[model samples]
Target: MRFTPVVALAAFTASTTASVASDRYIVHFADAASARAATHASQFAPTERRLSDAPRHLRSLAAGGEVFELGPDEASRVSALPGVDAVEEDLMFEPTTVVASLWKRQWYMHDPKVGVDAEKAWKYTRGAGAVVAVLDTGITPHPEFDGQLLPGYDFISDAGAARDGDGRDADPTDMGNWSDPGECHSPEGKASTWHGTHMAGLIAARAGNRPGIVGLAPEAKLIPVRVLGRCGGRSSDIADAIVWASGGDVPGVPTLARRADVINLSMGTTGACGPLLRRAIEQARSRGSVIVTSAGNDQKNANTNTPANCPGVVSVAALGRDGAMASYSNFGNVTLAAPGGHIGDRGADDILSTWDIGKRGRERSVFGYRGGTSVAAPQVAALVALMRSADPDITVDQVTQQLVDNARPLPGPCPKGCGAGLMDAGATVDAVVEDRGRY
Candidate 1:
């Protein structure tokens, strides 16, 4: 009906919201239209779950909280929870992370501490034991990923769950936009940007070769999951995608997808997040996926964004090239910082990276410039991939500590924002290997 950014989500920041119905209560719609709306709006697709008619009494309602994938049994229990009826799948993947100002080049991959070091990557770990799922636009067939792109399901389709039935899609091409950025375009059809592709490049763009650019983890593989389509995916779609990415099966999707060790979501709604997204994130973590999300770029504070504010997830704030907190970055509870660029008197002061040319609106190939906390998220994801590769048993806690403890702290506004400091890739890698010595 009407297009809104659906930002500054209330569900995400709020401690809790009133439940709509019992997790297991039979949803009773007052009329068919109401049920149809719930069905259509649901991410479950063709075969959705809903109440036939409105219940005589209200048992509970949904609130904002990233839900993780639940085993069929867990689903039942969640249904058994006070305010949960049919659990409409929600995508826990938040794809918008980074300072949009950094759409060009921000982080110094060459810095010794954070520098791009293939030699060291070879010496320590090549990221073989890990699987990273990039829930954003899409990925083109590229040499960098080295056929590491696993099979993924798309949630953008009305049929519910897009499958590459042809078994195609293993490319590493960049999808870009010029004026617009991100697959999460404004529904008004304003612009486009291949933000997701660019972020992946920074994380795992083929390394060791003297090609266009270098990545943080050359040996890591990315699971391309397109949750945010044209104008971005709805909360319901995101929730479903999250369950699927973390190795869960919805009612219709018979096959349980392979779970990801690390899930990177760069997107976010500006307002307090709705229950739609929060439950999915919570469920994914329950399934054992470390969600590394971007703190919103609303130019306000970090404590505001959905998915980012969800607990257990490692929320990252932004920093500038000057090595200070990026003016546009939201700070509070910030697990770590990366180059998300800064807001300037003129506009955005970005420390960017090479993005998919498509987002830049390129006619030729897929490499362009883009920025935002969306970009910063991948750098951290790549580092985690490396950590897992070094040690397959690496826990989420260890990976987080490596990023924070090894980060190069910058001048901060205080504990209110920016929990740790700036992220250093080289330092993160060294810390894991030196400390564990196991993997």
Candidate 2:
């Protein structure tokens, strides 16, 4: 009863200026001096010309490249000009063809070109026996996770941060994390977020259930490990949760019957990976868990963000519908990219997943859109689940290698480096299954 939808390929028609019949083109210059010389040359009419109806300047690249709207004949002339390295058409790219789903909002899951292509991977496995531990603000009960939830634990040490009036406990229910003005560091107040539930839904929300959205690995089990809370979470709590979630003992907390096949950490802070967190991640990886974490939302180098910067983890960066790195997503040192969606008009381009209605506390559940590297990490986590489901004996290194080897290049450029490329769930899972045949 998998919710397989008809895929719709978006057709794009290139348009030309009606007045001048011009198309966009980029002229790459050999050097900055050449670029400046071309601007003053009479043959090259730069967009800044005083003409009232002049060709538009689309963009100016920092590396002495100029994008302009030029007629085909004019483009040829520019290409033949001295000091011009090359002239190429400015091409337009969109997210891989979208799948028409029941909700129609899960574009990220269905985009086969730039997305993880979970739909294609589903033909092989739905991550049946894999377990994913979501370490975040915790989760709220929802219909999307009816039989997919595992007995999770609360690891928030501070009662105030937990907002549950207790220290550490077994209940991982998300007690609203609404904060007062200046409570956590910000001047304005913040809402509960329901961040964990959204991430869980991305990983394993049921597929054929009702009219709701489908997850990447619908059959994968989710263990909601509460670490973040009211303001945020502590490094110590997160470290302990990582160890316990991977079946390591955490003193009073009972050990998990099954270690998580994939550990999803969507939370992070600015600084080097602390010794405690790094050790915990190493321990989890040693136990055969594939750790996936967000590259952060600061749009800076990911090397400064904890857990993501730590070794032996897949630090993921976010991609928008245009197949480029999200404007707010961290770039350098990322393991790969995934559809994290973008802040579009009225939140049209954000990732669609399960969410709660309450602004300050738990209320009725609903489907909503959120955009960030936080949302991107879970998709890769689910992909790991699917890979494990395909070949249960695959080692953590093998899994990582398969992901890197099978990933396709981003449709656009990632100047700061986005690891291997974008994750291709179908190719990765297929490769794993094929490799299993060899053995």
Candidate 3:
């Protein structure tokens, strides 16, 4: 059995698209003032039939459920209300996965931490105080990440936060594998979830613990924010989670996410980072969180992946075990490459790690091998955490800059996609040391 990340509260069960009809509705108000007004209270007098389940507005509404979804006529009536704003319909799009991870057993890879001719840059740097939010599947509690989770929030349908809903918090093997309710007999094989969980382990798996796998940052804490579920959340939900994780707004959602210095978006949409995602990333950047994302799995040049392609994000490309760029990795503007491993093969696929260990109703063997750039993103994220531990107050931009500055450039057809170069923990540590000395 393969274990990745647990998606929704329902856990193992899957959902058929046709089975659930996504309710489409509209919100109308008197004027721009009323409509754009904060989620606190609608400025206009809402009609009885007009109701809403607006994510941000419910809090200020007197009865909480006072706001209702109304059709056109009701919208028209509400429009006549004193402070009506504009009326708009809610548009929901399917959610997508984002990721990158893994690193171990590579000799040529920079390891200034314990090398004969180790660089002096690492002595002064060690990822001081940066917080990287892992927004993929769910993170399993492993001996490696024992004390690594900082403060995680589950965006899986909003109810099962932290706890997997089985009354326990970290059940490694009980991840929800992806299975398109009606995917079979389609094109690809049956879909499943938990790919996120397995990805998480690759990046932060405990180091030096004599464990199943080694991570990029053995000491870095994880902030598990679950944004995926059975099927997935609409764009709205993902956008909300992105903003909230970076210390932005969401009405009903308590301020669980503090201001993180960095955020790891190991997920992406087939579509680009649309308006909502773009806006959310911009807002979060304004608040100061270094956002890192996986370039994409599409094997095409100039292939732009959402959030990854979004402005001001560090998009990582994937590399095979032997240092050649993974042909499948999306390349145009590759930032750098780290070993993401080759699926179902060894030597050619040394980048491996322990996967979901405790999912329910599944076969006992959850640990297995797989590879890709999705596995590489987290490797960088865990590195960010270690850098934070070394210096907690480091600015998001500064950390990102250091990463770019220190990465060992790779050789390839298009170096652009690989960014500064392959991420080297020891090299990065050395650069930080130099950075601290200059400071």
Candidate 4:
């Protein structure tokens, strides 16, 4: 009744050790003249004589200040000086990489041959006003997602699988999906994936946040639709979520105020496309929602994978830094290929995004690297958002055609067949904007 996610992820290691040297402080003066005069005062003689160099003066500031190293005992002495307004610690600031090196680690957004070239695409549009629905294990709170998430629903019907006690509610927060030994047909227990959070970050993590990697469509809005959880989620629940996300009515569920322009399905099961899912996809497409799906990680014919194999969906295949089909990626029937990274011993090539540090419950937030067609699918979905933002009236068929027509051939080989080609974000957005006569 349920299917597990097709993803491979690794935890990022970080350190919180503090520096043990004397703290630096900035002494603010009531006026610039007072600051200048204080530099020569007897009260400052001790600090001037103790330090190797002169204090850095900030006389141009509205409340002029001076930055200098200060011992705890010396700090108290300076705080009591005449005309000194305030003396505060000069805090050290570093790049966001100190917490998580997502920006530097995101090679898929820059590399010319194999990457999506998202930077070049930004010249055209940032996907403002577009909405994308992420249907997966649900989302977790992260700084990168601040102010970008829309009110979402939890569609997991089974009480045990939902893991929050009772079935289905308004909250779509990921409660952690760690499973026991032999759970969900696995040989051993597994940690919570925090999958939907990662997918959402890849689609639209806030830009200019400085601490995390920028998403493909930084201005787009995300709807976190909870479908998979615990051992996995049922197909029926996923089907219902698809309809609800695209503005279709479901029994006992409130109508969605804003329909998503793109629906991202990053989880799938083996076997033929079932009628239940087919109808949902058809209904979503009829409402102008372009559906995107992962081709699976089973490394076989993707035609045997549901949803990916389903009609009326844009199925994506996984590619590594080499632009070849990933060793773990399923192939045939794929619509496009995108960077999914190959997880080797070092995991240096994996796609890095926002994540959680918890194993089975809520914990501190962090960024991590993940691989699989699940990761690759969101890249296409985000691109679809950009396309929609450029031309709000673009049809679903037009969106799919532009993606296929502008895709570039993979720089590496895919003997088993990958897709139309590798996704070229720059070229694809250019083509769409041009088609709308925006040139």
Candidate 5:
């Protein structure tokens, strides 16, 4: 079944009533001393709530910092303070999914014009010794991942959202995200997306061994972390997933033996990146994890999409078969573009990846075609895996820089905001192997 575009997370709580502005504000100070000074200051003291979850390493942005109820005037005043590094209005967010038609072939990964050059790039490296974390709806036991899958955990904190009748367990199986009509407060029900399965297949489905489509990184290992579920997942849950996937601790969750070299976030919210998410992303980066996220499919500027809009992520845009930007893909913050596949080209033009068969509860192994920025982000993530394989010590910044510098120019409407242009897998691998950064 084709997946619907994901609704925005609850983080975007704005009203059309111009008279009533958001009063909640988040302030980031330059240091602990500054945060303490600001918290005690007459202006900040009266309104600060002192309720935050950020860790000590995060400094002023952590729990040590303070959240406040403030009007626009006061927010502006705080933004101008020398001690305040940044001040933003507290808001909610939602995840965006790209729309696509269903197809059953894997031609999108083979075609040169619109596809990533995975074949040639594979010659340089099959992404050995690299681990990719798929932070979405967990994975099913598909043969395409015989020896490529790694031990993973389910990070869905809410038992109802997990749908497995439990809260946060180690089992990362996809129990099906199918929902009854209005089950998730929706006007209509949704089919189990099996989104993580599709993404894992694209990144590292076994090559030349099985009857299924070959993944971009045949030798790379995949770590599935279930975040999205039932109706959708919470942004807070996703934040913790990011930290855990990058080999960081999450209080009670068990520590992972292997840390991810590349973290693929095919999902995100629509509002500004909250401090919780920003903290997770920064921590992941500090551990040398290259983060890749979808640019969204709202047909608007991607700079407005969280996680993608957040700094330190390689935000991806979707390209169609005609080598143009997909009509639904978000732009602006795109770090690079990839074949998200286009609709109306029949099934031949859409991205073909692993999927499941049967209705919800009775799912089986299968492959299908779909397109969206979600499809595009995994392509970038896989390439990063290859880059990491080529140079095991590569940093997050280096991998992103290599992709941007070696990208081929776009041939369509996107000139600037669509990133450096389409991703060239072969060239990107070559650059990494040659150690181009030193030059």
Candidate 6:
């Protein structure tokens, strides 16, 4: 009837120094008293003494049945204990691309010929204090974000497209965009791309973790506004999201607690901008938020694209790793080109970013490659964040001017209308510092 005394974790660590595996096990008990009275301390070694670096006294072996390191035999014995409920292994997750395979793949972020020079720009600013609203499919929980992700609004409006079977509330998690052939009028069924997740990673995935891809602006915050869904989001829903993301008021929707300094529209439709879209952009502009849109992947004149061609929008085109226009990227009216990958690259020259490797019932966080104007736009959005971090008072007009002024000509033959030229993150942030110094 003797009970094991609850001793300091350091003492427990020093007392039972048995060889053990790296697997940490969680043992659940029916009650704290049963755990405290149990004499299983010798069988199950205390793993993490402190509960996330809490005080020593609070990390006793009997302190709320904390985690323990146990081998197979030891774990089995512990599971058979009188009051033990269950035993499971503790798992760690690093949310980013596989760095070994990704270092060479992410040439779009560093290659001077076509990349955005994120390395140099990062030296200037990592986009701290700035917020970029991703108006795309929702976002999911991942380790790539170090508490910099904000709870964003889901403006799907249509329950069917939402796939979550709800119109919209505050949950912006991307429920896989999987769809049947007839769903959303697509010619064939397609798996979800986790588009928003990839975009968010590009804008600000946690940096210096030593495992995965680093973002252009690692310290920036992301506000994921889920406007697009299953097949494609309705323009009405997208317009509402734009308005709400910029801290503008929308009927029936709650007010945004924080406004975005920059809004990214990676999705777009063909034809001129409609009244609904125009009104939302106008309102967002009035609130001092800059809107950045993809120049469409249709390989046609971007002037035919809706939001890209919208007044006051900074439209972006795509460039391949070779410093040439991506074959699929639409031209004309483009603000500038960023690495979006070319069709000829197959998977070799695609933009590498964070993604989920699973489909349907088996979802796991992993990194993959994708190419399109959609991928290109986030590069600029991240650059804008760095600019905001450097000069909080910088206006949308100033962003446009700085980009135009600092752009370099295309390395090879330029397309019909590549706007100013290529997006130079180093030059852009330097220009901001220079402008501030002058003023």
Which pairs clash (backbone N, Cα, C closer than 3 Å) in model 6?
none
Candidate 1 lDDT, 363-404, residue by residue in tens: 433344455777777877877888787776677767776777
Residue 61 miss distance in model 1 (angstroms): 79
lDDT of 3: 0.55
Stronger candidate by lDDT (1 vs 2): 2
Residues 250-274, model 2: lDDT tens digits: 9999999999999999988899998
- By summed lDDT, which 10 consecutive residues of candidate 2 come out lowest? 4-13
Tens digits of per-residue lDDT, candidate 3, 1-439, equal 3221122201211221122222333544433334344223433333331233122233223322223344344334443434333444455665331111223343223333211111232354333345567777665555556666676665655333222554222222325535443643355434344565566665455544243554555444556776665545456766777787788867666674467666777666576668888888888888877777887777765245777788878788777655667777777765666656565454524445555443432333334566677777777776666666666656667777878877765633444456677777666766665566455
Whole-model alpha-carbon lDDT for candidate 1: 0.58
Query: What lDDT tens digits, residue by residue, belong to model 4 across residues 332-409?
Result: 878989999976553769898889999889798888889989999999999999999988988999999999999998
C-alpha local distance difference test of each model: 0.58, 0.83, 0.55, 0.83, 0.78, 0.79
Model 5, position 56, has a per-residue lDDT of 13
Local lDDT at 22 for model 1: 26
TM-score of each: 0.63, 0.76, 0.63, 0.77, 0.74, 0.76
Model 5 lDDT tens row, 1-439: 3211111100111211123333667877666666554444423222223212111111234464457655565567556655567877668765331111221256555565666777678789989999999999999888778888888889888898887999898988888889988788887877787889999999998744335677788789999999988887888889998999998999889988989999999986679988989999999999989999999988889988888988899999998878889988998767999988865443767888888884575368888777889999999999999999989988888888899999987856775379899898888998899984463
Clashes by residue pair, model 4:
none
Local error of candidate 2 at residue 295 (angstroms): 0.2
The reply for model 5, stretches above 4 Å from the true place, is 1-105, 343-346, 436-439
Point out where model 2 deviates above 4 Å: 1-103, 343-346, 437-439
Candidate 5 least-lDDT 10 residues: 4-13
